[model samples]
Target: WRRGTNSIAVLGAPQVILYKFGHPSDAWWGVLPYWAGLLILSAPVGLTVYYFLNDHTPPKSTPLAAFLLSLAFISSCVWTDLIASELVSGLEFLGVSLGVSRSIIGLTILAWGNSIGDFVADTALARAGNPRMGAAGGFGGPLF
Candidate 1:
């Protein structure tokens, strides 16, 4: 993992390290997998971007632009992490009350968010050229 990416993992390192060392509980195991999965996935993305982008392109805008983009991406990830972590932390109650588990919530929320975004964006693009389509976009959509 890249040096910067280490900070992202550091966010959840305590619980994960503790759980791996033999702390056992359903919640502990539950949280561990999510943190581990996030750590594993995030490390590679940062490493890949760092290795490939490090020397390839000239600086754009200014050092500030680079800093801002990095901050933006990290902040976005942190917001997502916050939601996932909060939901996981409260999984037991949520699972019982909602009649579903953390894994199901994660799957459905992420899947539907992406699907909805794609549906909206695609329909928007498709309507971009036609006035009739654009006019219809506000009231009806792709199926219409």
Candidate 2:
């Protein structure tokens, strides 16, 4: 693997370093493609202009509605975190029982387990004729 001056060693595996293109001294926009940087910077500006020109009104939502939605979101986040921890623990136990290496277990089982939902959602979107969005999620989900 090619290592760059900007790369940092991966946790638990000191030999592995992830690299990003461009030097650390390079401007933030310099790291991205010219068109990508332009688009990223311009999108919000364009949207704001469009909304202002169109005189679009924001949706009216009650405090109760907002509170309930926030509560639900927080609850789901906690629930998922718990589920993921349990899953990791279970996978570790199974890997030990099967005499599998930690690296193999992490790379295969943990990776797939975490990403299965993204895979399914992307697959569904692709099947529904929104392949571009599906492709985006497929490629982008793991990065986040």
- Whose lDDT is greatest here? 2
- Scanning candidate 2 in windows of ten residues, the lowest lDDT window is 9-18
Task: Report the CA-based lDDT of candidate 1 relative to the real structure.
Answer: 0.54
RMSD each, Å: 11.5, 18.4
Task: Give me the runs in candidate 2 sitting further than 4 Å from their true place.
Answer: 1-78
- Tens-digit lDDT string for candidate 1 (10-123): 444444443444333434345655445555655654554445443445336766346546655665666677677676667546666978866786687655754685467657
Model-by-model lDDT, in order? 0.54, 0.57
Q: Per-residue alpha-carbon lDDT of model 2 for 27-127, expressed as tens digits?
A: 45457644344446545544443443323332247553353345346545655766777888899999999999889999998888789999999999999
Q: Backbone clashes per model, in order?
A: 0, 0
TM-score of 1: 0.31
Each candidate's TM vs. the true structure?
A: 0.31, 0.45
